[model samples]
Target: MKIAELLRSAALVTAVAMIPATTATFAQVDGRAGPEFAKLFATYQRIKASYVEPVEDEKLIRGAIDGMLAALDPHSAYLDGSDLQRLETMIDGNYSGLGLSVVMEDGAVKVISPFRGSPADEVGIKAGDYITHLDGELIYGGDLDEAVQRMRGIAGTSIRLTIFRPGRDEPFDVSVTRGVIELEPVTFEVQAGNIGVITVNEFSRDVGQDVFRAWQGIQREAAGRVNGLVLDLRSNPGGSLDEAVELSDLFLSDGAIVSQRGRARGESLLYEAESVYRGEIADDIPMIVLIDAGSASASEIVAGALQDHRRAVVMGERSFGKGSVQSLLPLGRDAALKLTTARYYTPSGKSVQEGGIKPDIAVPQLSDPDWEKRRKYQLRESDLRNKLINEAGLKDEELVEDNLADPRFKLTADELKEQGVEDFQLHYALETLRRTTPSAVALRR
Candidate 1:
């Protein structure tokens, strides 16, 4: 199948264009893998004739498709029915649900991250927590799609979740009332020292435009005295590739942003600045992009681009290291294949597959009480089974870096709270900008 323009991370989904099937397709496949096809057909026949229980054709075929995709990588999968509906919901950027990005791990529903300011986040639903039961119903070893369906309902509905958090003594129950999760992809505020904090929750549609507008709002709110900018991308699971490029272009005036290369025809492409948004929206403003273990795919794209271009100082823990690009290839009217089509690289030819975009300055989130414990259980692209290997042959030490032991960051969560610092990373970035001159913030070579 020809690759689509759509690209996303593991947590997000994409809508695809349906490609008309050609009769030559089957002939070409048959000619190439005739023996493999014969063996598959024979296995199907044997199962149909000799299996103890009579299985539906739909179940067998679906299982086969699932099995094929499962062997490739964690990001690729078959999409149909509710899966397709979920894609629509994500693209619309609004849904009535728990506002969680989840994944199936060893038949368990794992929370990738909760949308900021959502009911889940408001209720303290954290990443690395596994949902074992929904509304007192055991959902372990259940379909992820089914579990997701159970979590979603009309607004004002409540669902009780039994959470099995790592490092905790026992599974705990949390009752959360679902709400209309109108995902605000970009939320901006002017912080102290005339620093504009633009938080990108996800790389959903129009995020580039949303961020541009947010910056404008920040300038207006700051009375045209904006000193610095913070592109907070913490826990952003990633969405459209176009938006990632557009967002990167906002701070970059020229040069290649990113490029993707794959084995298939038409799979290789290059994106550059000034292609999407024309010129840098905040060209002179010193900017810092914040990331963590939750950042992946399109988040890496934006971070990688800005870091490569030296437009922004990337600060935070090492990223999730997902550099593979996934494209939604339509299988039929209701189904599609979310396949890993290409491996993308930064402008300097750095692949962030297993070794994600390394921060210019590693800043830990000291404000989180469970930061140490949660980091141990935090999942990234490298942690996922059947992940694409980094071609660069990343060393063990390179993948895992010890947090810098700065005496300044020695405050406990309670101590930070007492000082009115809720987010240590953002506080650090704002302070860093405030301390440095504009030229020092830009770090132009």
Candidate 2:
């Protein structure tokens, strides 16, 4: 539920706590090996000797571990041995799993999105599907770390998942075989009208290079210049800051694309225009970037920078507002402290925190305020905002099915299906590209 702590908390799901985080029992303090460290050690010893109720050394150890990790920022956390190994595989960019990214939401594990070409996608695991139960046990009370671990295994093994998809009540079971998930960072399609569509799933280490090459390929297919470009970034939980900067540079000729500010060190790094692209498309390009709540971190940087530079028009709802940076600090032996180090700024000097970057144009979800009354009437996420249906009777919170439209994606369903991309967000983006010309206005994708 508290996503900020997800990075580190994933490892300690099964570690029973001696003292609950509440109850005034202990202070969440981090003392640097001086008197404070001595105090913690001293108190820990006292707890073993006396404490009203009986306590165990293991309990004291857990508290000390929690405090130590807590001081190092929220992201850096202790992972159980097996959980740690699983994540390492994900980071290495190859995993034999169901191929879906999930989140613990509303007492249920929901499928946030499926990786391109993963077995989950092949088996039809869609975004917004709620996993009420995995196998036969209720997953609501289970640890998310365990849920993740259970869903992954060696290639060729079958795992049964019971999913509750949005717009459907009865949970359905799907038998999926795991495979090596190689996330293809780029997917392209030449639209019927000569429009070229490109969807960047996430800004991994090689994404920028893949994107640049794809751009060239599109240009070559269109011969000299492409009619328009659709850059779809919906559900792109960000990675690699370097890729964000590199992708921004591809569009910018010369300007301060982004800046990072932190304690003690302000403006330690300034990214600006080193050189203009000598390529033919350098002078002018019209693009539109489609984003949603799932687009975060580095994705927000690219969207914010491009929008500020007048390079692209940003569309969709606000971003995930994760502008803070993390730096890993050593914590003795295979352990490290991943701490929030800095807050990044857009080229225009805006912070993507608290309130995520808002779109230039605002389009409320179709369900008017008081949508709970209308949810029964709603079908698809698009149905919540069904303009044709009079949902003026819906509640404000209930009607905001804004994910139906991510600014980064502008293609229509027809176009997406034709391109073999069922992602609606990316479809919208490709369509947006068709409507604009480079000379008209700088755009985003």
Candidate 3:
């Protein structure tokens, strides 16, 4: 592929923590690095010559590369062979698997989030749950890629996953039937009171256009003026950066959308409004953005932009707070480095590195039976190992807002279920919008 197209391809998946990338020729190595290189070569030679078992050069080299990247950050990695193919398959958005976004955490595979309506989501596999075994076979301390490969199979296949939920007393097993995961990036529905609810599952290719079309569809379906809108991004492990910008631009007519700063030349960039869509699709409608611990990367970009612009009322919990950008620097024909290149910021110049986008109104999912338990173990960017620190520095009080008791959120899961409320956060947002006047939406600015 051409270099530009290759760069664009990198931003296509974020659930697995891939982001946008640009290729660049390697610069000449510094002469002072000769001694370090000599040490590395000496170690390689010693391993090949003195190790008890005959180790392949390819295995050693790959191990060295993996070790080097692992030291940098959780996101950076060496991609080749199966890894490269998996990325390509993700970009295509069709695979026979139990659809999930997961990350390796301290030798265990922890779910970032299950894709909406996927087999895993259907089977009640939730974010923050750790998979200890697959088909009753211990998988802890194993390779994440291998575990993921085992979970994916023919559509009719079923996999038994042993889950260790943080608040649960014991590990439980779940049988998930693998199916063709065809990601529907965007979906829209018109609710009562002519309100539109648009759920962005991920920021995959053409998501901006998809959202624009969704608004158009909602308008047609409503058959009248839309009163309010809900942009549901809960558990949306983010995707493409460009699509994030495009989606943000759909709601923002003017102002700085997002910016990235890096040490390398040409790495820094500033994206503004009117670059993708000319004007807001629903400029006058009251809007609310729903986020949670699973909303990350590109998801943060959109939330931060709209919140900074005061165009939407951001509700729910703080986001996953992944503000850094990654680049897929090609090493050879098959190998590439997914390296963290730059840190992005909101229009208000807030870096969402460790301190993710805090909601304007903190609304907990009271309908979740394990809401309190899960909150105690909720994971965010700050929870990740070796995460980039927010230069602004997060205060203790800021990150610890959940500890306060709120009498308003006392409804139990059973109580809410009896009241016919499946999702408390969405219900809250919809009710907020339904009751909000146009003047009230404007007053948020």
> In candidate 2, what are the lDDT values of residues 156-273, reduced to their tens digit?
9988888776556567998999897876777877675567667888765566778888888887787866666666676676766666777777877778877877663332466775
TM-scores of the candidates are 0.93, 0.71, 0.95
- Top TM-score model: 3
Off by over 4 Å in 3: 1-8, 15-25, 395-398, 442-444
Please tell me which model should have the higher TM-score, number 1 or number 3: 3
| Candidate 1 ranges with C-alpha deviation above 4 Å | 1-27, 30-32, 441-445
Task: For candidate 1, list the clashing residue pairs, or say none.
Answer: none
- Candidate No. with top lDDT: 3
| Candidate 3 lDDT score at position 308 | 92
Per-residue error for 234 in candidate 3, Å, reads 1.2
Query: In candidate 3, what are the lDDT values of residues 1-445, reduced to their tens digit?
Result: 3334445575545522233333423345687999998999999999999999999999999999988888877788887777776766666679999999887899999998898899999999999999999999999899988998999999999999999998889999999999999988899999989989999988777888999999999999988589899999988878777889889999988999999887777778899999997877888888999999888889999999999999999999999888888777766566778888889999999999888999999999999888789888888878777777788888756777766778988889999999999999999988888789858963357
lDDT of 3: 0.85
Model 3, residue pairs in steric clash = none
